[model samples]
Target chain A: MTAEYFMVLGLLGVAFFSVAGALLGYEKSISGFGVVVVATVTALGGGTLRDILLDKPIFWIATPEYLYSTYAAIIATIFFVRYLPHVNNYYFLLVDAIGMALFNIMGIEKALISGTGMVIAITMGITTGIFGGLIRDVICREVPSVMRNEPYASACLAGGLVYAALFTIEVDYIWCILGSLFTTVFLRLGSLHWGWHLTIFRKKDFKNQSD
Target chain B: MTAEYFMVLGLLGVAFFSVAGALLGYEKSISGFGVVVVATVTALGGGTLRDILLDKPIFWIATPEYLYSTYAAIIATIFFVRYLPHVNNYYFLLVDAIGMALFNIMGIEKALISGTGMVIAITMGITTGIFGGLIRDVICREVPSVMRNEPYASACLAGGLVYAALFTIEVDYIWCILGSLFTTVFLRLGSLHWGWHLTIFRKKDFKNQSD
Candidate 1:
């Protein structure tokens, strides 16, 4: 759809995923303060980086809507955490996918508007989709999903390429957005269900260093 | 000191603190892959924020020196960690102080150069000094020093004010740098030594409902 519509969707995605992140943090027995920290990071961290890289004044600092939305997410999660034991893991994956798709579209659109080439637009899109989650994992002292075998950044990359292809073909903007979103969702869900993973290591002939 | 000298010192501070952060993360059982993430955030996070807020291209992206220095720092720490176990905590504090002081001075200087008012400059300086560490702590799933009952931000604020005062009085650049550095170090060390803290929590007689 339009860039304005994408921005609105991106904000909503952030608010939703922020709640999901907070719930995950609560499940991990992270402190209340820690939950808030993780929630805000999951929600605002990607968009913040995107704005910074684009040299735009931070969207949240100017609008206050993002901040209030994230705050609401955190409060909602905290109050509902006890009643939501089994929902965290599934919700995490779902909301994360939504956030990744929305951010990918928004970042690519912004880069295109800034007169960047398709390659740079795709790079920025993947960066926007994954950087926040990477930051969140690093803060939570967990290995980021990117560094793992999981197809996290891969999904983003695929979605970004799809978006660029759709744009190049002059497809309707709505169809382009849906195309990218479905690609990311299917890739992520398939990876989760089928245990699909990238092979990052190869058998080494060398002995142990101590030898 | 000349502005060039301060910038170099600040870079060195970033290098040193990044190494120190890596070592601490290792000790905390943070994953090997995550060490690089932590180091990058601890070292470059604040300046990155400052550049973004100023709508300037990120310095490290342009110069490459900052990234190279951080890489070197990580390698150095990984090799030296075992031989320096007892000193890790001390080194962490020392490097943190140096980085904070240099960042505080640099941030204030940059703000002044940009023609910002004294108050905003001071605020930016403190924010620049502390935000990286705040990010680092959050990633490590620890309570940020700022949120704790510590004088972390207060020390930076004090140093920033001293820098502004020196500038107002037309003090020589070298002496102004020294004044700010000394003020920051003394305040930070004194706070740690005597458990000094700023008054942050107003009395809450009612249920704590605010998020």
Candidate 2:
């Protein structure tokens, strides 16, 4: 697949996750302003982090297409707010995971192209992949799935490593993207299917305080 | 003051907030690893977001002093975990506000130096000021004060505007810093003293769902 194809996929990912973010916001008493902000944050937050860390001009600033995409997503969400009820019930994980899978490869490739080491590339990939949803979930006032038992960040990590390994072995770059994408989507889907979860540990005397 | 002075002050801010972050971590059943990660994230999260959005190399990568300070703070927290209970009682707000005030100016200056517009500079200032604490609270499973009715981000916003206005009027940079500093600190202190908070409005049919 061409980079343009990936870019299109990434844009779709942005739209999907922004809708998810807007839905998350709507569950609360989030106003229209809040919905727009949350949608943009969810769609662009991770890539913004990646671009900033790479010390490159932020992607959206250079290419207004991304911002336009986020705006479009927010507008779509606002118009369809009433139809967003079951959004959190089943659609959240799928859209988020798909977006994560696409963004993960994009971040790894960007980091590698910028001449970072393999470890940093992989870590950057995961950071770019999950950061948006992490911030979105946090803004929505829930524990991030990565911090909880969900296999979110771990899937990104695994897929990033797969991409790195493939790229290192002189595999076709397209294959690398596909391989990594499938790994992430399958891992997340498999986890959901089997109810796989990470274990939580606490101090011997964990105190739960209500704020 | 000299750049070195700001550097020192920034490091001190990082240490103090890392201590505060670890204390927050300890209040839960978070393990030592969790404590360390939370400390690092809280100490560096805001600046990381700022630098990234500004398209600069992260403040910590070029200078490891900040990370070392965070480490020192986390080490202190680990050894003194037994004494962290009272940390959340009264000290949390003071230390967090002080850190926010300092970091707020630092962000504004950095943005100004980067040649961003006044609006972006102010936004970045507030972003840098409160992002760490916001993430810290979220990670610690509490609502971020700024998200609710707290005057935290508002103080930073007011102080950032003060700094921007002073700079626009060609005031001495040191005076700008001090002016903004006092504004944020005094505003926060006043808010705490008089129980000032923003009024929240929930939509009549808001739905609460666990994600």
Candidate 3:
């Protein structure tokens, strides 16, 4: 509704994703400190990349509140998941979709305001939405879901394209933001519900080699 | 050596890592274009992070030659590795060590010149050295070697500390660079030769959870 409102939602998104990240690290048998590190990376990694590419100060470094929120969420989730068992499993997709939608739209807005072209703006949006999970998966020694046949980055890309197109057509900023966020969340949730996936292609003669 | 000499060596280091990245992507059966992307990420990912954290213009975007070098090296490696299967395997560690040493020292020098304190400078140096490989490994669905028991980041840390300590003691700039480079390369190569590795630790009661 308002910039301030969006900011608060964005921080909530960061916290939700931190829970996912911490749970992931817990699965890997990481230590307490290590789980915190992994969760922080998962929460802030995408925004950090977007800001860096835009040559802006890193978002978390510029706003300590995001870091604080991430830690707070991580602590809460650790206890909740530890006691509840299966809570994280049930809510992972919902949290992931909400976080992706919030971060993706915010990234597009930041890139547009920075005067980048629509394509770069959209690219930045997708980067901000997906890279945090990608980095977390890497650290936890898993292939990123985005790289699989899942509709992860594709959902971000669709949302980014929608936002850019709406902005280009002189849509109001609020409507543009809302439109994009809805697109991302809807697509992500729908895909998960229906088991929709992207297709993978490879060369006919390509041989898999273990290096 | 001269600054110009180090600059040339740095570009070569980028090229070497590009080859390693391309080879890894090839092992994963990535498409031709995907290999190029992965290789470029592996080569430039660290320096990009360094420049961003330092709030400076991205080095590759500022100097397009680095991008050109990455592309050229990726193409070369693709052709080279396709025909010569064992080549990448034999040369991977050497190329990685050289690249790490060059990038690590350059990062330290850049941070010091940027007026950052010694600790930040050293941290930036390690970030520049290892983040590229870390990102690359993540994209390729492998756990980063640095996050494992490997001495990868530890070598960078050791080198960064050496450089900062030398510079603090009023060592000549050239000597500082040389000292750090030698330290990194020696430790990395020696670790491989002697099978030395960092230790992993976890809580006694930590139970592995599958998420």
> For this target, which candidate reaches the highest lDDT against the unseen true structure?
3
Q: Which stretches of candidate 2 lie over 4 Å from their true place?
A: A22-37, A67-88, A204-211, B1-23, B29-40, B49-56, B61-131, B138-211
Q: Give one digit per residue, the lDDT tens place, for model 2 in B1-211.
A: 4688679768977877887777666665464344555667888899998987887778775566776778788788667655443445456567777788888988887888899888888999899989998877777777777876668888999999899788889988788988998999888888888987765675543644321
| Two-chain DockQ for each candidate model | 0.08, 0.18, 0.15
Query: What DockQ class does candidate 2 belong to?
Result: incorrect
| Model 2 root-mean-square deviation | 8.5
Clashing pairs in 3: none
Q: Rank the candidates by lDDT, best first.
A: 3, 2, 1
Q: Report the lDDT tens digits of candidate 3 across residue range A173-207.
A: 78887888899988888987888765333423443
Stretches of candidate 3 off by over 4 Å are A22-40, A52-90, A117-120, A138-141, A186-205, A208-211, B1-23, B30-40, B52-55, B60-130, B138-211
- The TM-scores, chain A only, for the candidates as listed are 0.91, 0.86, 0.88
Report lDDT per candidate: 0.76, 0.78, 0.78
Per-residue lDDT for A177 in model 2?
84
